[model samples]
Target: MEIVVSISDMKVTSRAKDVIVTHALGSCLGLAAYDPVAGVAGLIHCLLPLARDSKAPQKNPAMYVNTGVPQMMRAMFGRGATRENLILKAAGCGRMMHISNQFDTGANNFAALQKLLQVNEMHLSAEDVGGTIPRTMRLFADTGRLVISSCGRSWEL
Candidate 1:
């Protein structure tokens, strides 16, 4: 079965047959982590770069890159996925539109995610990020395969 991770959301599973996917990633970012040895995988869709701006963490911790990525990682680790064995992949961080380009939210989101990953001692094994077009990201739990697609073209990582 396939699990759709919505914006400001995440999902983790150990089932080999499960596929975690997030669609229409424009300026927003998609972060994925997988552990092939444990057969565990997770996907997070983060909208902004920080959660500190929001007073209510319980209301939506998944809305920010800072909070969401680690939350999802914890979920993956709780399911037997080791930090050292985790393979990270990221996508999105697009310009998306020419109008209203004052703040590059995508770039900021991606940068914050990178910092968070580094602080966690995690590294990205693969990535498909930054463009004007939108994208879709998928993580296959069964084999820890990540596929990113855009403009009718797909790349496996």
Candidate 2:
């Protein structure tokens, strides 16, 4: 089964036949984590760096990197994924047009994610981030393979 993780959303699964994916990653963050031994995988697409900056109280914690990442991690752990065995990968965080450098949402989003991971003693095993093009990210639950695609090119992260 293929599970689509939309913008500001996440999905976690332990099913061996599942493939989790997220698309249209421009200025957004696509994060994937998998535990090979546990046969568990998760993917999260975060739109902003922080929930505190939202105009109103955000109902969906997955909408912001600060909240979303932790939420996704918890879900993965609940599904039998362990922090030590988790292989983390990331994609997206592109500098899109019409978005000024002063408010570089992509850069900020990545930075926030980095900070959060560091605080939790976690780190990304691989990543394909920062550019002007949008991307799509996919994670295979059975093998913990992360593939990132952009501009007609696709590669493992």
* Cα RMSD (angstroms) for every candidate in the order listed: 1.4, 1.7
TM per model? 0.94, 0.94
lDDT of each: 0.87, 0.91
Candidate 2 overall lDDT versus native:
0.91
Judging by lDDT against the true structure, name the best candidate: 2
Clash counts for the predictions, in order: 0, 0
Alpha-carbon runs more than 4 Å astray in model 2: 53-58
TM-score of 1: 0.94
Residues 107-143, model 1: lDDT tens digits: 9999998898878777898877787889999888888
Q: Candidate 1: where are CA atoms >4 Å away?
A: 99-102
* Residue range 14-99, candidate 2, lDDT tens digits: 99999999999999999999999889999999999988866422589999999899998899889888999999998888899856
Any residue pairs clashing in model 1, and if so which? none
